[model samples]
Target: MNILVISGGPRKHGRTAIAARFIERTYGFHTVDLSIVDMPMYTGEEDQSSNPFVKSLRQSVLDADAVLLLSPEYHSAMSGALKNTLDFLSSTQFLYKSVGLIAMAGGGKGGINCLNNMRTVMRGVYANAIPRQLVLDPSVFDYDRDGLNREAAEQVDGLVEELKMYARIAKEVKEQQLI
Candidate 1:
């Protein structure tokens, strides 16, 4: 299925991206990392209707069957880049769309706040968000010659399973007649 995984963490290669990539690979789903999409902060002054970035991003979201929001906790919330990305899209962009949320953190809250906050935001946009998502503890890291820790390697399988299940069900139901 066409899946768009928006990475909400500032660090492009951080744990959140890694986890997202793992899930993408597991499902063999097509994903677009919004972190790499590159758009200036919304100013309202810019006509999103005409903005090429907004246009392309919106096109991708519209084309995708589901969206995977991978976020990190920032001030008890999801990252601003992510929030802004969603904000830029607004209700006009996401209505009737399916979304899945994933969050990660090094410690403490482990990004639950990020997940919850993004979920709330999704609600505001009238998105049909998937109920299941992955929350990863950074300690799962098994740092190797490449990077990350052993725990990261361990968590990969389970997280991938969750993503795959969601994708399968969503793809089937989305393709089938709604009951």
Candidate 2:
């Protein structure tokens, strides 16, 4: 499947980026690291469709068979950058698309809230977010800073498999509906 992983951390070398890179390297998935991209905050008052970054972001979502949102917990919620990026998109870009959620918690205890928040937004955009989500805490990196430990890697593997399965099922359903 053409999985698009969006790294929504503010820091380029943060935990979210590490997870994104690991997924890309292990699964050959495409990644959009938001920390390096200068995506203007979505104000809804301006038409950013013409903006190159916004256009690219929109196109990326449109081209993906599935999306994996990677975010770091911040004050019990997702980063503002991620929320703004999501605001630039609509149901047209995500409807029926399989989406996987992963949250990195700096405090080792706050990632679940971030995942919950992301799930709510995915619902609003009509994405078929898989039920198997992940919340990686500090413990996940205790054995490996650049990648997930053995246990966390297994969890991510399961989530990715579920995402791929759902993406295939959704694609088949859509094709059948057209016929």
Per-model TM values vs. the true structure:
0.77, 0.95
What's each prediction's clash count?
10, 0
lDDT of each: 0.71, 0.90
In candidate 1, the residue pairs with backbone N, CA or C atoms under 3 Å apart (3 or more residues apart, or in different chains) clash, namely 140-151, 140-152, 141-149, 141-150, 141-151, 142-148, 142-149, 142-150, 143-148, 143-149
Q: Which structure among the candidates has the greatest lDDT?
A: 2
lDDT tens readout by residue for model 2, 1-179: 79999999988878888888888988999899999998897878666789998888899999999999999999989999899999999998999899999999887566899999999999999998899999888778733557888899999999999999999999999999999
Model 1 agreement with the true structure over 76-95: per-residue lDDT tens digits: 88888888877778767676
- Which residue pairs show backbone clashes in model 2? none
- RMSD values for the candidates in order, in angstroms, are 3.4, 1.4
Task: Locate the minimum summed-lDDT window of 10 residues in model 1.
Answer: 141-150
How high is the lDDT of residue 68 in model 1? Answer: 78
